[model samples]
Target: MPAFTIVTTSATQDSDAAEVNTLTDDFGSETEALGYSRRMADEMLGLAAQLSLDFDYSNVALYDGDLLEEDLDPDHPALIGVWVLDEEGCSYVPAAEFRESLAEPEA
Candidate 1:
């Protein structure tokens, strides 16, 4: 069972959202997280849409907190992927790509 972390913070609070967004629950796996997140999908979508957050292609993200911890450095190439919110509704973005986007300047 893979450990999953839920990034829970109202999008309105950007600073608060960035700091320690992970939930206390340690989900067993992506499948498990998916199941639980699906139940709260509406709420998640509301938050994401409100903030226009890129965190998850979807609103609720089952972030692999363990994997993210293992690759804390943005420069690392072995980082795993996570969900992000996009126009398509939801999708997964590799860690490296996500970090790079974060590092880049917004037009």
Candidate 2:
């Protein structure tokens, strides 16, 4: 089960969970995966527009889905997909970054 780095552009610095559009599906090839991810970006941008979101630069650019396999470990327990709060907004980090952010309980 491969994972993807989904990106979304937004105007407001704050966007709730509902405003974030996520996708979880495997495709035939890597190209297709990226294509689908970009399409999802379009959907998200449209959504932002409907919500009347405004960006500071009047330019919002979301990232296209990219297969991140550089430092990903499927066996890691903390590699779950979840968004974390940032200065810009809530966004998903890479698998390794997510693991580093976790606070493990004392042994």
Candidate 3:
């Protein structure tokens, strides 16, 4: 059976240096995986906002939905979508569209 892997990347700050962690989990379907990813990204940013802390970034990527393996790469061609902590709030960007966005400059 095919499964989806959700990859989460979170940034942390401290007096010494910034820290980052990548986590992954598998889900039975794309819909279920995306839903869980969005909720996780939202909760991470929401807590940072509530505490008035410096929030660098947190994002979740959906990858390898057609594979049953857990070793999927976040930057692999199989990436299905991404959820980012946007300025307005947590926003979901489809992988295809996100690639285009990365090519553009910020205003």
What ranges in model 2 sit over 4 Å off? 1-11, 14-22, 55-107
TM-score of 1: 0.45
Report clashes for each candidate as comma-separated counts: 6, 0, 0
Q: After superposition, how far is residue 46 of candidate 1 from its true place, in Å?
A: 4.6
The top-ranked prediction according to lDDT is: 3
Q: What is the TM-score of each candidate against the true structure?
A: 0.45, 0.37, 0.69
lDDT for each residue of candidate 1 in 12-86, tens digit (9 for 90 to 100) = 332434433545356766677766655555566666678765442233444555554442433544335545544
Candidate structures ordered by TM-score, highest first: 3, 1, 2
Which prediction has more favorable lDDT, 2 or 3? 3
State the number of backbone clashes in model 2. 0
Worst 10 residues of 1 by lDDT: 8-17
6, model 3: CA deviation in Å?
A: 2.2
Global lDDT scores for all candidate models? 0.53, 0.42, 0.68
Instruction: List, residue by residue over 1-107, the lDDT tens digit for candidate 3.
Output: 45666666656444344344444555766787778888988887887778765545557777765443445544568898888774467888898887777778989
lDDT of 2 by residue, 65-94 (tens): 333333323334423333333335434445
What is the total number of backbone clashes in candidate 3? 0
